[model samples]
Structure formats: structure tokens, C-alpha cells
Target chain A: MQPGISKKRRAYILLMRILMWLSVALTAGLVLFLVTYVMAKGLPEISWNLLTTKPSYLSGNIGILPDILNTVYIIIAALIFVIPLGAGAAVYLNEYARNKKLVAVIEYAAETLSGIPSIIYGLVGMLFFCSFLDMQTSLLAGALTLVIMNLPTVLRTTQESLKTVPQSYREGAFGLGAGKWRVIRTVVLPGCVDGIITGCILSVGRILGESAALLFTAGFAHAVHGFFEGLNSAGATLTVALYVYAKEQGEFGVAFAIAAILMVLTLLIQLAAMLVGRYFKKRRDL
Target chain B: MCLPMKKRQSKIDPVTGGSDIRPPVLWDSLMKKQAFENFIYGVFLLLGLITVGCVLLITVYLIISGIPAIREIGLFKFLFGKTWASTAKTPQFGILPFILTSIYGTAGAIALGVPIGFLTAVYLAKAAPPKVKAVVSAAVSVLAGIPSVVYGLVGMLVLVPGIRSIFHVPDGASLLAAIVVLAVMILPSIVNVSITALEAVPQEYEDASLALGATPTETYFRVSVPAARSGIAAAVVLGVGRAIGEAMAVMMVSGNVANMPSLFQSVRFLTTAVASEMSYSSGLQRQALFSIALVLYLFILLINAALNFFLKRSKEA
Candidate 1:
């Protein structure tokens, strides 16, 4: 609007804004671009044999079936512990407690817990939880360790969702002479179903993608048979596999294939969570 | 029959707008009421105890189990040493160089990520059309949900080679490449927190600022930012915590070498140092790795403490 605010100055301001946004877009693009380029280069090396077969000493062209199996096993096992434990904790925090001091402490604990570096969790997983349980890098120990790593996140998300339910609904239920348990089950739980699902989906992303705690407790095994045996066994995950392949794989082709697999898996997870969440929300609306 | 009826009548009368009543002997007993109340109270106490117990046990566990390596390495040398060869004859555990590398890398990332994240958050919160805001926010969240390992994979493939060619570096996996990737990795946390903070600024403040002859942008920088400074500060610290604590993505493209960080050179960070050598390490060397991990954890803890302190100060102010 001013006379001195000429074309050059306006142009400079516009350019700066564009550059600022370009960086954000570029930052987000870095991973996708990398994965696409490498996977395109190396997908040929990936085969059914590479996926289904076990590792071999003689050649670099081995399979990751066991590692993949281990990753799934630990994640499922982790969810088992995380869901019940974390959801229960969230329930307690949201439904029962009335004291502000107690609530503050729980909130502080969550922030601090999330801040602790994962490597320390790995060490503790190795030292106490795994050793004491006699689980030794087995799915049981890995799951237990990850349960600790994930509980805070799971609890926080669940608690936020649970809190979103209307208090009036709760009061109405109570006025009907329903017991406390019945009120929570019939009114509160049903109302927050979507939020809970969102939390669980987000948490699954964490458990599947995590590497540090698994580093010590879920020592890589590549067996896909007999659920217990495979679970108890140690091997690799998509993450650990990518790490191992990138560092130790003699051929760039193999390494790139593994990296591509990780990228696709992660993108699928993000997409699935969003789509599933939206689908459920749309259904509820209808 | 007559006595039972009379007792029931008395109990009902006392509870429902009746005179103080006497119940029959068995019905009037105090034991049942005490037991029920005690059980209810006990359940509440147990839940409280569990929360307290968990926080206490984990903190104590981290400190007790994670300190031995620090003890062995000695403070100055472990923190300030340059060599990080876990398999070497002497097995030097000087993680100082790695620590500094982490610092610089984290610094670079925060510098690039925070501003854009803040502005984008503000746009999403205050400026953008609602539909566009929703899409952008979801995109940001998707970026957040994408695993760190996946980010690492991308860096290794696209960013590395792209940087190598663009900057004319020998390797694509250099400090600059790592910085760009990490900046992306941190965007979600920064944006999400900052948006919440910006949205928290009361609308009336903006209206009032506009009445004083300030432009929208001026009001935003001076009024909104300062008013939400505490939240922004908390957001920044939280990002730092994530950046420093992050391991998988940094390890993938940081070139995992223990040396001073040159902008174009490959460097290892404290996180990458532990992760790369962890699978093969043993003895004092492994302990030293644990020490480095402890240092990383300590840095994060310090950030958290600072966040709480700043939040308190801001609240008081």
C-alpha cells in the first residue's frame, strides 16, 4: 500500500515466503525420494527366494523371512501388553481419579518417560527384564521391554481420547441408577471408540517401527514356522534388516531393495491409519 | 413377621424423608457397610500406587543400571574424547567428538525445521483456509507417523545421492544430507505442538492489536509470538529432545565416522556410535557405549527439565 514498497521489495518478500515453504516441502520429500530412487535401482534383486529363504554364510543372496517373522511376533506381543496395561492406566486416570496433584504427577511421568533415550531402555531390557524372565532376546522379553517403551505414548493418547467424552453423558448415565462400572462401559467407552482406535493404530506404528529396545531383547531370527518358536527366536525387523543390509550387504542392489521395503512399509502404515480412521469416522457419521 | 416389617419400615423411613429409624438387629449391623467402603477405597489407592510405582522404578532403574560404564570411563575423558573405536586394542571411548557431532547435527536440524514448522503451524492454525489446513495437518501427521527407519531408508537412497551430486561431495551421506533428513523427521512434532500453542492465543488479543494500527503480520510476530512464547519454547525444547534422542534416522545417513563435523564430511553422532557398534561389542567397550547412551539420555533429561522450568517461569510471568 505504500509508495516506497516497490516491485523489488515485494518480489523479495514473496521469494522469501516461497523459499520458506519450499524447505518444508523438501524436508518431507527427502525420505520418499530416497526410497523411490534406491528401490527402483534394486527391486530386481528382491525375489520370492530372498523373502522366504533363510540367511546363508556362502552367499549374500539370502532371505529375510525369519527377520520379518520376528518383527511381527515382537510387535504383536508388544501390543498385547501395551493395550491392556496402557488402556487400563488411562482408564484409571480419566474415570476414577479426582486429585489434581496425582494427575499432574502422572502427566509429568509420561513426558519424562518419553524423553528417556531408547538405548537405555535397551540396556535395561537386557539387564533386568530379559535376564530375570529367562526370555533372552525372545519375543517375550522384547515385548515386555517395548511395553515399557510404548506404555507412556499409548497411555497419553488413550487418556486424551477418553477425556473427550462429554461429562453430561456420564452424569445422565449415573442418574439412571447405573453402577459406576456400567456407566463407564455403556456410555463412556462407547463414545470414545474412534479415539481409542486412533490411539491403537498410532501405537502399532511405533511398535512395528521401533528398533532400540528390540536391539537387545529380540536378537534377529529368520524363522517363519511354529509361532512360538519363531517368536522366541531372534532375527531381524524391517528396520534392523535395513540397517544390517545397508552396512554389511556387499552389494548396493540388495541394500537398496531392503531400504525400499522399509519405505513402502512405513508409507503403508501412515496411509492405512489415516484411511481406516476416516472410514470409521464416516461410518459413524452415517 | 410383625417385627421384620416394623424394622424395614423404620429403615425406609429414615432414608426417604422419615424420622431417624431403628433397623432390626441383623439389618442394623455396621460390619457390611465398613467392608464395602474399605474395598472401594482400596481399589482407588491401588491404581494411584501403580502410577507412582512405575515412575519411581523406571527412573531408579535407568540410573542404577546405566551408570557403570560412566564410572569406568571417567567423566572428562568419556565425554570429551575423540576416538570411538569399540574394537580397537585400547578401545578408546572418547565420545566427545560424537557428542559434538550430535550437537551440530541436532542444531542444524532445529535451525531449519523450527522456523518453517512454526510458520506452517501458524498458517494452519490462523491463516489457511479450513480445508487446506486439514489436509496440510494430516500430511504433517503422516510425516510424523512414518517411522524413523523409513526416513533413514529415504536418506540413504535419494537424499544421499542428491546431496553428493548437488554439493559435489564424494559421498551423498554427509552432514548436510543428514541435517536435511533430520529436519524433515522433526517437522511433525514441531508443527503439531506449535499449532496448538498458536491456536491457544486468544482471538481478542489479535483484534485489540489491529485496533492499534498494526498490520496482521506485525501483530502476529509481536503479540501472538510473545503471548505464546512459553508454548513455543516448550515446543522447541521438545523438538530438541526428539532430535538429540533420535537414533535410527541419524544412524542411517550420518556416515557413522567418529570425527569432527565438517559441513561436507561424513560424521558419526553419539546415537549412531552406539547403534552401529552395539551388535558386535563386548566388555569395557560395550560399557563405554552404554556410557555414551547415558550421556544422550542426560542431555534429553536436561531439556525436559528446562522445558518444565520455562513453562513455570512463563506461567508466573
Candidate 2:
């Protein structure tokens, strides 16, 4: 640290710093390398027929149509059941609640829930939503489980974002003699649109990537005729499909295809979220 | 978005600027205000009640479903027993090996994960130029976003085969693969938390350390690691919890074996066993699989509670 320090001492210090950071860099690199290699090796054998067709273990036709159908159904069911509920919860937390202590507790609980492993949610799903509710291995069960799982993260995130709507904007509306509901509808909600979308996209990404909880509660379905009518449906997500294919022999190629799909979906979600965030920032500037 | 800088003057403020303020519709305004307050209170109350109900419903169901299985297996054997198989008549539920695998797997992941994660965070925070920080942080989140299943597949293709070739193992899947992949999977969490923790250490700590003749590198390790231990520990706990509960990826590479973890041998964790066989399982077996999940749930709840406690205490300190 001293200006008068010996050159040898300085050299030794530099060496120590380099070594410390180098080890860390090497580890990260190795991890990334591992992931990238597996993906590349597995990518070659994928074909469109594999996805459009249905899986036939006996016939050797490795199709993913059912898995795709199930994934779509899960998303739709989640949207139908959870969007209104989550939005309602956020509205109450953001606009109605006055007790700071209660607010803090909710916030803390929600944050904890967000950090929890998805598999725990799966366990809870199988128990409460699937068995206790008599909605076993059905789309209803999976959707309900997702509602609970996605609630804390989404509601808290939405509440936080909604709360960020400028108080002055609401006051301005009020000063103009607008009703409370009208002010909230016209100003506060719009202001929080970008933030809510951010939360939605983040949660969506989590949902797409989620496998652990979905495995048991959703059950595995190869195919479905319709998305809406399949209430007592069992299905697999792309992530789950990848898990299924990766484990068994001869389906290694199919596994990589699923992984690629998941990765691309994730990237698209991230890109959209970034775009939304950037748009908000740009709009605010205007 | 911005909060109200100042509370707006309500209609009841009778004397603004010392002028006589008269409101003929005072009762109407007051009633409206009261109603609005009531509505908000009602909503928050409902939400609070629902949140608690959600927590209770899950916890209670886990207990209800798992207890019968535990009673049948006998609680001691369910927790400490090594043989975990279930049938109609004689259901053997031994969770000891899974417990060891989870604990040991998590420990190994931490050992491999923390150092690398902490260093990358340091590099990203301190050494990496500011312009690069933005892209790097996003990349880290991308790492976080990558599904564990994908990581498992990645392990299968890359880690598994690489280990086989490098170490001359019989097959690709092994404990070695889990250790490597889980460590990597948890790296971003570690780095993100560590950077935050390290950044939180007051600038004065560095200045004071420098004044005492310690270089930045020396100060970073000697002083920074201790100061940021709480946050770092929180990160580690989160990472370990993640590793312990991780199923799909671990299941893929773990060979799904229940034996003790040799460096090259693959092992199924409690989560893996549950997830692996849940599709075909029924009756006591299904219940037992859920019981494994229940055990993990309890661990998560406990770990989270402990984490919140530590974070609170750290903030207070």
C-alpha cells in the first residue's frame, strides 16, 4: 500500500490477487463450458417430426406433441386462475393496507416464498391441492398449485411496483375532483404497467423453467385433444420432458432438443423483459 | 414512480393559512373517507388471512399425508433407515442414505461453489470495469434462469462424459457430476449475494485497512470476508438449500443409486427418489415419496426461518 514498498513485495501482491481471481474465473468458465458442451452434443438429432408427432416407446417414435400441449394448458390454467387473484391481492396490499407492521410481515413472507425451492411447492401441491382437494394429477391441481407458488412473488412484486406510482399523480387526479377509483384506474395502474409486466415476465420465466413441483402434481401426459376441456389432465412441461428424455438411453438427442427449446424460451423472456424495462425508462424520460 | 412527497391536506383541515375554512358537506366527505379506509382494511385483512391459510394448508396437508406413512414405517426408521421402498403390505421407508446424500452433496457443492462464486463476484464488483458490470450481472441472472433440468442435461452430455473421459469412470453419471453441476448452478446465487455483501461493507473499512498498511487484496480477504460473512452465509444457505432440494438435474446424473456416495458412484437424493418413482408409485409408496418431500419441506422452512433470523440480526448488529 505504501509508495516506498519494494518492487518484489508489489510483485508478490499482484501474484496473490491474480491467483485468487483466476481460480474463481476458472471455475465459472468450467461450469459454463460443461453446460455449453452438453447442449451442443445433444442438439444434432432433433427433427420437426419429433415434436409434431406423439411419443411411442414401443414404436420408437419419440414425439413431443403431448408434452407441448400440456405445457400450454398449464400456462393458460395458471393465467385463468391466478391473474385475477394475484392482481386483486396486489391492489389490496398496495392501495388499501395502512398497517406498516402487517405490510412488513406480508412482504417478508412473500420474499421467503420467492426464495424457496420449487420442489417444496410441488410437495405442497400434491398434498393440499391434489389430494386434499380431490384434484389429483389434473390441470386444475397444477394450476392451483401454481397460483399459490406464483402468488407471493408476483403479488409482492406487483405491490412494490404499484406502490411506486407517483403520489403526486394521484393527488393531481384527486385535485381535479376525480374519484378514488377513477384516479387509480387512470393514473396509478397505468404508471405501474411496466413494473407489473416485469413481474409477470420474471414469473413466467420461472414457470417455464420449473420442473420439480410440476413432476408429481401435474402428472405426465403424452398428449391432449384440447387445452381448455382437459381439466383432469396430466402433462409434462418442456423442462420435465427434457428430464424424462435425458435419463433414458437412445433419447439423448430428444433431450437436447427440449433443452434448446427451454433455453430459447428463457432468452426470449429475458429479452422481452429487458425491452419492457427499457421502454418504461424511455417513456419516463419523455 | 414516486410516493407522495407530502401528505395532501384533507378536507378536514379547517384552517389552512389561518383562514376560516367551512365545509357544508363535511359529514359526506368524512363518511367517504371512512368508507375508503374500511375497504382498504378489509382487503388487506382478507389477503393476510389468505396468506396464512395458504401456509397452513400446505403444512397441515404434508403432516396429514406423511404422518400415516411415518407411523407405519416408525418415525425413527423413516428418518434414519437406509432402505426406502414401499409396497402394499411391507413398506420399507429408510431415508438415511438420502439424508446423507443430500447433506454431503450440498456440502461438496458449497465447498466447490463458494470460493468461485465469491471470487467472480469480487471480480465483477471490483476488478471488472463498470461498463462490463451491466452485461455480466445480466449474464449471471441468465445463469440463474437456466432450468435445473437443463443443467442436468448439460451434466449428462458434458460433465458426465467429460468426467468419464477425464477420470476413466465406467459411466458418465456419478456424484462427481452432481458436485460439479450443482456447484455451477448455485454459483450465480453466491456471486450475486456476495457482491452485495462486499459492496455493503463501509468504504471506511477499506480506507482504515489501507491506512494500516494492508493492500486491497489483503484487505478484501482478511477484512472483507469477515465483514460480509452474514450476507455471504445467507447466500450459502440459499445455495445449499437449492442444491439439497434440486431434483431433476441431480436425478439425471446421480445414476439414481441409493448406495453411499463414492467419488465416482452416483446416488439418488430424497428428492430424486421421490421424483424418479412418483410417476408409477401408488399407495404407501406415493405417500412415502411425499414424505420425503415433507422432510425436505421442513428443512426449507427451517432454513428460511433461520436465514430470516440471521438477516434480521445482522441488520440490527
Candidate 3:
């Protein structure tokens, strides 16, 4: 639109701008359609009875309480293992590691772990945890598999927060005659609590949505049990249950109901993550 | 303090320990603390090594379990075979169909996804107003956070039927459907990564271009894009990995048939081949599925290496 611009240059800029706008419109439109369509189709199928009771074969009644419980159990188990392991790894990398080569190797391993897909993790988990370890496709095996899958996420988040904790704090601790472990235990670990919390939320979201990884390591079953018993038993999470209902059982109604729940949960998680991140950022700035 | 106390304990305690027992007690407590510190360090070191140990465990298990089927089937036929019939009376375990389908599907997704993703990223990064950028970025993150099954569900109900009615195909589930689902599914990753890369291009570069009398569009394409080409390349590689490794969504819409890939024909991917049969397969059939998984893993490893190379180059740049 500038007065001195050539006609060809003007046309080129116009074309580029139009193309860019079109692409944005397409992406935004796709998201809008998906969110609305899913909510419309899935909301009607969710009922209180459908949520609280277990599936009954004789009465042809289906409920998702078991899947919900399994999801919670698996998330609890995976987090219990992943947090310490991931935080410890991050601490070693940032705090104690003096060997650059070892740091590079560990960081590279984390990257590779993130790059590998869930299905491969499922396969390997099935082979190692379920079969070789003789865990027999229980929820415990699935949780262990998820612990491996989520370690990188937790490690990266914790590492980022660890970096933000000023070196002066550590130096001050040392100045006060504190040893390395004590300094890390008291000062460094507490500073990264936000990151650990953020990582936990992210991991829970992923665990909630994961199907391919859990399909094998955690077999699809509808039986409900207590937390400890659930870990020792084979049961499906909400995502896997949705898959089984839609694909295997021709129960699109149940599938949509579960999908709606999952969609709501995903939104809530995204919001929580944003809030947590902003809260920590504000606190840190203060 | 501990060092001085240890010296005192060594020299004075041996001579008059009964009278001056405080130094020995202090030395013993200090040694215990040091040992505890060492033990805690060892524990942390072990935790750190667990990641490496996991990587090794996965690699070793895949190799050990994946080799047996390959040895039995012979590598050439297994890799280049034309048919895959895992349950037939005389089974044909050739996975050429799967490999080719996977390649074509990923290529198709990249073909469709990268351009739109690149353009959107460019707009968001360089052209959009702040409010627009914020809204679109939120949408992209929402897309990313939506589970694969939800995408598959939407695709199965909406896309498959739409494809069937529009194209006049007997069935809606086909390679084309899978490609479309994958394209949409990978959009968030491509757009997010490319936006990061494009945003990282120095403001000075664009300012220099504008000062040189070039328009913003030309500057972005000719100068800024070229500057961030490595990052864009990494985004594309990442999209490829996501497309190739996706199982559940593709399985839902691809019809789960092991046929040679045509745009409109039902076909299976390497991932779907492993997943669809995993629950029911047994004996040699099961082992063959593991072999398929191994093949898929190798493909992923290669893609991962390429992604790393591009990412490293971008970081260096």
C-alpha cells in the first residue's frame, strides 16, 4: 500500500498476506468445529447412573466408574515414581554433575525418550514389564511404563526451574558451611516446587489422555477395585475404555460420554497449567 | 570445624581419651555425617542413571524380542514382502504393505500439514497483532492437548462419512482419511515449533531488510525464513515423526486392512499393524507383530536422529 512500492511487490505482499490469513482461519475454524461438535455429541450421553455404577453384563448396563478409578490409580502410581526419579535426575544434572560428557549423555537420553512414541513404549512395556518382569499386564506395569514415558517431561520442567534459582543462593548456603546435599535438600529442591507441580499436572493430563501406551501394558477391563487392588489388576483407563467402546463394542454413546469428560479434563488441565505457570512467574518476579 | 576436630581427636584422644572424650565423639559424629552425605550422593546418582538404564532396557528388549521373528522370516522377505496375512492358513508375513502405507501416509500428512502450519506460524510470529497471536496460540495449544482418541472419534464420525459421500467410495475409511486426520493432528506441533523458530529470528534482521527498502513479506521469505530454515526443518521432521508413529487415530480411520496404499483404498500402517493385532495375536503371529514394532522403532530412530541434527543446527545458528 505504500506509494513508492512497485505493482509486482504490492501484489506479492497481498498474496502472502491472504495466504497467511487463510491458513490461520483454517486452523482456528478446525479447532472451533471440533470443540463444539464433540461437546454437542458427547454431553447428552453422560448420565449419573452411567458414571457411578460398573458395567453389568446381565442387565446390559454400562458405567465408567472402574475406568475412572483405574485412571486415578495409574496417575497416582506413575507420579509417585516419576517425581522423585525425574527431580533427582534434574538435580544431578544441574547441581552435582561435574562431568560435561555425562550431562550431555543424560540430557540426550531424555530427549530420545521424549521423541519415542507411546506405541513403542507400549510394546517395550509389554515385553519387559508385563512379560519379562512377570507383572502380567496389571495396572502396576502400566504405571511403571508411564513413569518411563513421563520422566523426560518432569526432568525438563524441574531443570528449567532449577536454572532460574540463582547461583547466589547456593553459594550463600555453602558460605554458611552447608554441604552439597544439605544445600540441595533445603534450598534447591524447594525452589523448584512450582516446576514439579507443573510437571505433575502435565503428566496427569498425558496419563489421562494416553491410550496407545496403556492398551497393552494395562489391559482393557471393566472391573472396579480398591486402589491397591486396582494396581495389581488389569483395567482400562478412560481413554482406553473409550477406544474399546467405540471400536470394539460399537458403543458410540459411551465413547462420546467418555470423550466429553476427557475434553473437559483437558481444558481444565490446560487452564491449571497456565495459572500455575503465571502464579510462579509472578512469585519469582516478586 | 570437622577437619580441625579430626586432627585434635587423632593427636589428643590417643593420649588422654578418658579425660578428653569430646574430640573422639565429635570425630565419630562427623564421620557418620560424611558417610550419610556420600550415601545420599550415591542415591541421587543412581536416580540420575535410571533414565540411561531405561533407554538401555528398551533397546535391549526390542533387539532381543525383535530378532527372533526376523531370523525365522528371513530379513529380505520380511522387509520387502508384498502381503501381510497373519491369520491365514498359509500366512504371508510380508509387511511391505504396512511400510509403504506408513511412508505414503506420513508424506501425505507432511504435504498437507507443513504448508498451512508454516504459513500460520509465519503470520502469528511476524504479522499478527498481539491479541490475535494470543487467541490463535491458545487454540493451537488446545489442539495439542486434545487426546488422539478424541481426534480419531471425530474423524471416524465426521471425516469418514464426509469422505465416503463426497468421493462416492464404498467405505469412508481409507488412506486418504488417515492422511487428513494425521494432517490435522500434526498441525499444532508444526505450527508451535515453527512459530518458536520464526520468532527467534533477530529483530535486527527484519529491520535491516526494511531499511533496505524490501517489503515485510519479502523480508520474511527471503531473509527471515532463510535465517530460521534449520528450525523450520526441525519442525517438519518432528511432524514426520508424529505422523509415522501415530497408531490409534490412524487405526480408527484407515480400515485396518493390510493392502497397498492408494489414496482412496483401505490400508494399514506399521503402527496399526502392531496395535490392531497385539491383543489377539499368538505364537509366530505375535512374534511377527513384535518384528513389525521393531521395524517401526528403527524408522523412528532414524527420524529422531534427523530431528536432532536439525535442532542442533538451529541451536548453533
Candidate 4:
């Protein structure tokens, strides 16, 4: 085999090998640089006071408590509404819908929804939810926009896990005189818990990272309030806050702190997704 | 209902409790259950349509708001005209600069990003050890998960300044800076999708090539890569969509100026053009912002259609 190789061919192979290794190194290097650079610059800026207080013009100091709370409120609000709609759509696709054409149309729509960028979502959200619907630039409008954006993720995941539920189990339930709703409620829905949870994690990660979509729908206000009050008022999530701070206010310290927090959250979400995947795999194997 | 059920029960007598109460009771409950099931089914069916309804709403909203500006500005002048001074005394609404900048910037990102990402995918899919692959893939996922704002922050504070000094430019924020940020941002999609496509190539293809006295590297590239070209193309299309649609990251570094795009000149993209002006714009300017969004949306729709085409072809192949 070695003797059969010509010098030109060997040189080409060597070049490719070198190129392959170099590209991989560059990819890895970029990731490393980003993670370490953000963390190194940001972690020191985070403080107990910074996380727990609000910005006061009198004090001429800034804090992100309101932004943090708004993030939590929007995430919760979006999930509360989205899970039911998303899971219901999945159930319809998996258990109820008999029309293949209808299912295909819905799936295609979901794909389109996912492909449309967040900026477009912001524009439409501002138009329909904020202006047309008279919701104004409030967190509620932002949450509704996110529900539409994440609906596909939730539906796809639930549909995947629903397929894994054995058909024999469904038949057995039917044989025992269980109605269609009963069969889904007792057998199919439980089987999809893992997917729904995974979807929630992914949505949370997206919600945390999102800024452009919320910029118009959720105006950048730093008001701390209860969940219902928060939803009615305009506010900024961490990502939006980071953008405003960095771009407009020139507050690099606060921006970096938020970046670090987001990075850590991203890491945690990745870990949780992997762990959930492994756990489900082991249970299925068993 | 109770009276009828009692009469039916009495008709069968108390001889067999199970058999006596079965017919009317069963019929009644079955009808009720069927109605309930139908109700729930309709509810869920409605739920499924909600996603479709949302897509329609977005499309309709964009068109309705987007048309006025174009109608006023003239489509040719709006899209092809070379000036975009929304606040000038006479105000020109031409968006050629934003359009060209978006196109050139996306092209630049693809040019710089795809080769490295493709090579990396090949290495991860075929050449790297299992342990190394695992670590690198995790890193890639982290890159994907980082918020766009963070990328902008890093680019603003680091890459822009670096470019300004290295290239001897007056301003750090330029189209070149935006391109570099976009190239980094799109790396994850290209690498991940290409790796998947490469890994999906059947083992037997490589096995046969190896048995034919071809080197492993040769077999991997010539056989495996050709087999996965459709998937790689789909990945590239996906990256193009991402690069073109990005707003926040590009907005932060591209300087928000509506200049004709040059490598080191400050420029605005289609996405940034909409985002930066929406807050304060009024009258025709406001409608024109909507029109800009419409343009960006149309670009995204084209990218999405191309992505779907590539993906469908890949699946078929």
C-alpha cells in the first residue's frame, strides 16, 4: 500500500491532513477564546449588590435586578401558555389527526415559523401584539411572540417521543375499553414527558439569549414588579439589557456581567439536556 | 336520565346485575363519550392550526405595513436607488446600500467560514479520536448557545479595535468587522450540519474504497464527501440564512451608517436599517422602516426556500 502511493498523491494527502487538523484547531480555539475571554472579563464585575438592586439615577449606579426578574417572569409566562398549545398540537399530530395533508401543512408552517428570524418576529410582534392588539410594548406581548417562536421546538420534540410510545400499549388500552382521550391521557402523554421537559430547557435557553425579538415588543424598562404587573409593563431581559448597556449606555462592566451570567446558564442548560438524553436512553434500553 | 336508566334496569330484572344494566347505560355513556371525544379532538385540531395562523399573521402584517412605503417610494427607486437619507431635507428612501452590504457581508462570512467549518466537520466525523470529537462538539454547541449580543460585545471591544489598528482604519466599526463577527457566529451551524452529513455516509462506502488500495484520507474525501455534498450544501444554505437575518450582532459592529458597502467602510445592513430607525421614525419614514423589514423578510424567505430545497434533495439522495 505504501509503495503504491505516488509522491504527488502522498503530498496531497499530507496537505489535506494538515488542513483538516488546522481547521479543527481553529474552531476549538475560537470557542475557547470566547468562553475564557467573556468569563475573565465579566465574572469580576458581578456582585451581590449588582444582582439584587435596581438602577437609580440619584445614585448614578446601575443594577440588573429588574432585568433578571423580567427574564424570569417572561420565561414563566411564555412556558405556561406555550406548553399547553405546543403539547396539544403534538398530541393532535400523534394521536388525533387522520389527515396526512393537514399534518404536513401544519409541520411546514412550524418549519417556516422556526426559520423566520427573531428580528422579523419583533416587527410582526410589535405590529400585531403590541400595536394592533393594543398591548403596547409590554412583557406580555413579548412572551406571546416567544411562544410562537418556540412552538415548533416543543411540538417537534413531543412528536418524536410520542412515536416512541409502543403501539401495542395503545392497542392494549383500547382493548380494555379506554376511549381515545383516555388512551392518550394515561398512556401517550406520560410517554412524552421527557420531550416536553427537553423542549422547556431549550426554550428557556433561547428566551435567555433572545434580544432582537424583544427589543420592540418588550421596551427596555427597569421596573421591578410582581409577575402580573411585570407582564403588563415594558421591561428588558438580560440579553436586551446587555445590548442597551453595551451599545447605548457604554456600560461595558454591566454588559460583561450579563454575558457571563448568560454563558453560565447556557452551560447549565447544555448539561441538563445531555443528562436528560442519557437518562431517557438508559430507561428505554432497560 | 335516572328514570330511564331505572326503568331499563327493571326491564332486565335483578337476575344478572352486569347484564341487566348494560344496554341503555352503555348506549347513553358511549354517545356522551363520543361527543366529548369529538370536542377534545376539535380543540386539539384548533391548537395545531394556531402555528399556521401565526405564520399567516406575520406574512399579512408585513405585507400590509410594507406596501405603503414601497408604493410611495416606487419599488425600483426604493430597492435599486443608491441613496437612503431618511431625514435629509427632501429625504431619499433608496436602500441599495443596505441591500448590497447585506449581500456582500453574507458572502464574506460564507467565504471565510465554510472552508474552515467543512474541513473541521470532516476531521470530527472521520479523523478525530472519539474523545477529541466529544470535546470539540461540546465546544461547538456552546458557541451555538451563546447569545448574539455577547458576540457583538466581544467583537466591539476586541475585534473592532484590533481591525482598526491592524488595518489602519479611521473607525473600527466597519463592514469587515461585521463580516468577521458573522463568520464566527455561523461556524456552529456549518460544522454541526456538515458533521451530521458526513457521519451519515455508510461505513461500507469507505470500507470498499479502503479495500481497493486507496488511502483512508483519499477514500474519505473522494467517496465520503461526494456522497454528502447535498447535506453540506444544505448546511451552507442554512448559514447564509443565519448571516443574512442577523440583526443585533451586526447592528452593534456595522456602525449603523447607510454608506455603500466597502470592506473597511462603515455600513448598515437590511436588518440594522430596520432596527436602528424604528424607534424615532414617523410618517413615511416609519412605513419605510416596515418596508425595510419586509425586504429583509423576503430575503429570509428566499434563503429558507433554498434551504428547504437543498434539505429535501439531500433527503432524497
Give me the runs in candidate 3 sitting further than 4 Å from their true place. Answer: B1-23
Q: Report lDDT (CA) for all predictions.
A: 0.72, 0.75, 0.92, 0.92
Separate DockQ for every predicted complex: 0.33, 0.42, 0.63, 0.60
Looking at model 1 chain A, report the run of 10 residues with the lowest lDDT sum.
A26-35
lDDT, candidate 2, B111-187, per-residue tens: 99888788777777666778667766777777888888888777776678899999998986888788888898888
In candidate 4, how many Å is residue B33 off?
0.5
Q: Candidate 4, clashing residue pairs?
A: none
Writing each residue's lDDT as its tens digit, candidate 3 over A1-286 gives 5689888888888999899999999999998998888899999999999999999999999999999999999999999999999999999888877679999889888988988889999999999999889999899999999999999999999999999999999999989989778899899999999989999999999998899999999999889899999999999999999999999898999999999999999989999999999999999999
TM-score of candidate 3's A chain against the true A chain: 0.99
Task: Using TM-score as the measure, name the better of candidate 1 and candidate 2.
Answer: 2
RMSD in Å for model 4: 4.8
Q: Which stretches of candidate 1 lie over 4 Å from their true place?
A: A1-16, A19-61, A172-178, A250-265, A275-286, B1-55, B162-172, B211-215, B309-317
In candidate 3, list every pair of residues with a backbone clash: none
> Looking at candidate 1, what is the lDDT of residue B211?
90
Ranking by TM-score: 3, 4, 2, 1
Error at B230, model 1, angstroms = 2.2
Better of 1 and 4 by TM-score: 4
Q: Estimate each model's TM-score.
A: 0.84, 0.87, 0.96, 0.96
TM-score of 3: 0.96
